[model samples]
Target: MRVKSEIWIRAYLRRCQAEGVPAVVVRRGDEAAGAIFICVDRLDGSVALYGPAPAGIEGGETERRWVACFKTATASGAEVSAYLARQSRFDSDLWIIEIEDKQGRHFLGEDAIIE
Candidate 1:
C-alpha cells in the first residue's frame, strides 16, 4: 500500500520545517495519487528539478531505490521555469514543491535514490 500523495507531502513539509529549511508547495495536485515534482532553488540564481521514477524502474527495489531522483544540473531560472512549464502542461495533477536552500538540500531523507 502506498501513502496518499497529500499525506506524504505534508510530512515532507514538516520535515523541512523541522530542519530549518524553507520549503513551499508551489502547486497542489490531487490529494490521492498525483506525482510529486520538487524544485530546488539553490539561491545562487539557479534551480533544479526532481521527480519519482517509473514503476518498472523502481518495482522490486528497496525503498531507498524507489525514486529515480534525476537532477538537472543547476541552471538559470528561465531554463528551469521552462522545463517545469513543460512538465506542468503534461501532468496537470502533478504536485510541485519549491525548496530554497543554498546547499541544495532537498530533505528527501534516506528513502531516496539521489543520482
Candidate 2:
C-alpha cells in the first residue's frame, strides 16, 4: 500500500482548489468515492490521471482508502487524460479516458464519459 506523500497530496489539493476544482480527499472505501478512481494531474505538457495498477492492489482499510483517493483523482471529468496518454509506461487495464476536464460543471457532462 503506497500512500501519497503528504507534501504531494497537499500540493495537489492546493492546485485543484486554485483551479476551482477543489481537490477532494476521501478515504478509499468512503461511499463518496466513485467506482473508478484516479489520481489526477498534469505531466509535462498534458493532463494525466494515475493509479496503482489494480493487479495486486490490496491492503487494509487505510491502504485501500488511499488507493481509492488516488483513483478518484483521475476518474472521468476529473480532468486527467492527455497527461496519462502521454505516459510511455502504463497498464493495459488502466482506463485512460479520452475526454479532458474542461470548465463545464454539468453533471455527467461530455467529459464525464469513460473512454
Note the clash tally of each candidate: 0, 11
Best by TM-score: 1
Stretches of candidate 2 above 4 Å error? 1-4, 28-49, 52-115
- Candidate 2 Cα deviation (angstroms), residue 1: 18
Q: What is the TM-score of each candidate against the true structure?
A: 0.83, 0.28
Q: Which ten residues in a row have the lowest lDDT in candidate 2?
A: 104-113
Clashing residue pairs, backbone N/CA/C < 3 A, model 1: none
Model 1 stretches astray by more than 4 angstroms: 59-72
How do the residues 1-115 of candidate 1 rate in per-residue lDDT, one tens digit apiece? 5777899899989998998889999899989877788778888897766777666554324232234333446667787678778877998998988999899887776555556
**Global local distance difference test of model 2:** 0.35
